[model samples]
Target: MKIAFIGHDLKFLNDAIEFFEHSPNISVKIDKWEGHEIKDEQASLEIVEWADILFCEWGLGNVVWYQKHKKPHQKLIVRMHRFEMNTIYPSQFDYHKIDKIIAISPYVYEEFHRVASIPREKMTVVYNGVQTEKFEKVKSSKAKYNIGIIGIVPKLKRLDRAIEIFEELYRRNNKYQLYIKGKHPKEFGWVWNNQAEREFYEEVFRKIENSPFKKNVHFEGWGDVTSWLKKVGYVLSVSDYESFHMAPIEGMASGAFPVVLKREGVNVVFPKDYIFETIEDAINFISENDFSTNNNLKTFVKENYSLTNMCNQIMDIFLEK
Candidate 1:
């Protein structure tokens, strides 16, 4: 099948590319209008119309804009990432002339229901897949501490909460240093809604500047997860709502503690007591918990969220037909 993904998002294009690498008969090409940038807008529209199936994500909004003008007939499978569908509001949702939907988490699908009516069969929940072969555990340095957070950082991510948690940890013992691998919002000081998000991110660099913990907060803008995992000593993801994803999964793949927030609906997959309620609690737990003795989470992720399991489940949907 000639599957074309329309997005600049690394996951939408890269993940599918990874699958195609392993897939026997599937042929896939991902472009959120690469030709448009070089040639003309009409040139990009040609690719979308030609594709057997279209996978739209991240910058799909850009294509939807063209849909208003060009009227391309691409059977879209819109994939929702974590940041795109956090709230269930009319303004928040971006509508495309789509045939089916692919959500990285269930939470996004439910949010989609709030915006438009779609049958359960039409919307598929395909959890994020980790390239386990590349992101396995690394030897942690005992003397030098390296705590990290690996994901897109929006306000919902609660990276500040992670910082506070670390502050407490440092007060008790200053062994661990922190690395937060997310871009800070460019209007943190002003009303974020009023300021453009990218502009706000520009301001955030100035705000966090010259702070005491500035040395600890390392912002390595998005890159190779497998390579990043090797440098990460620990991983923290404290989001308020998740369909079921983000840093924790990648961290777990890399043998990080995979600290997540304690929310009510989390019991479906995550075991009891897996959620941490407070920063104080996380501080205390990490201070004493010996990771060498705790590879249980490591094993759980290996068995469940591995690449083979994720791809098999996705292929199951097409095969069922």
Candidate 2:
């Protein structure tokens, strides 16, 4: 099978390529656009012509490009990760050319179905894969007070809300601290280029600056967080929305208990016990829950969200009628 995977963010797709390439009958190629918009029409056309199957990581503009240029015999599959469901991209997608729609979570699939009016048989849900073995480590006892939030893309993630919860946690116990691992707003430009995003980011920054526990709040730019997770007792997901967020699961794989907010379809993606409807509930759960000992968190993710399992499922989607 000749496969072409197109997307701006190809990081997650790398594992799929690596695993699939070893299969004797399969050949994989990636066209990394590296931008929000797909500008090279010629390149997209060439890819569509070359591949038997085209898999787009996000149902963004790239899928639209494939929809325009795709051959009659070719199978086009686009994975809806998140964010795109809220945008105009779904409406722009040419479903006539798309054979199947892959949503990372059931919630995203339902939302996409409602918005696009795609038939039930045309879609399937695939959870985001995590390399659980890579993140396995012995957590330090001192990590008990460290609360971690992995990704901070834009205002929608609600970092300000996280800080508010952190503030309340610190009031009860000064030992608590927030450790953020992704791109800080001060360092990232493109996501916050718009005035509304800029204002939202600035508001979060202002809250961080004014907070009494400012010194305890640490920001480490995006990188390999496998080692760092050992020092994090709790991983926070306070996002307003997410399709199938890998951060919380990754944290769980690394032995950090997740305290996820009640986002749309989050309950479907994560264990219901880990979810909270409000900041107060999250705080109470964290205060009462003991994460010092080892549990089945890693085992659960390894069994369900492993890269090997994800690849097999994806390959089935590609090969199936």
Winning candidate number (lDDT): 2
The residue pairs in collision within model 2 are none
Candidates' C-alpha lDDT? 0.60, 0.84
User: All candidates' TM-scores?
Assistant: 0.77, 0.93
Q: Which clashing pairs does model 1 show?
A: 185-200, 185-201, 186-200, 186-201, 186-202, 186-203, 187-200
On TM-score, the candidate that comes out on top is 2
Worst 10 residues of 2 by lDDT: 285-294
Model 2 Cα lDDT, one tens digit per residue, 63-114: 8878888888889998887678666788887768889988888898888778
For model 1, residues 142-183, the per-residue Cα lDDT tens digits are 512567876534555655577777667666666677776754
Off by over 4 Å in 2: 187-191
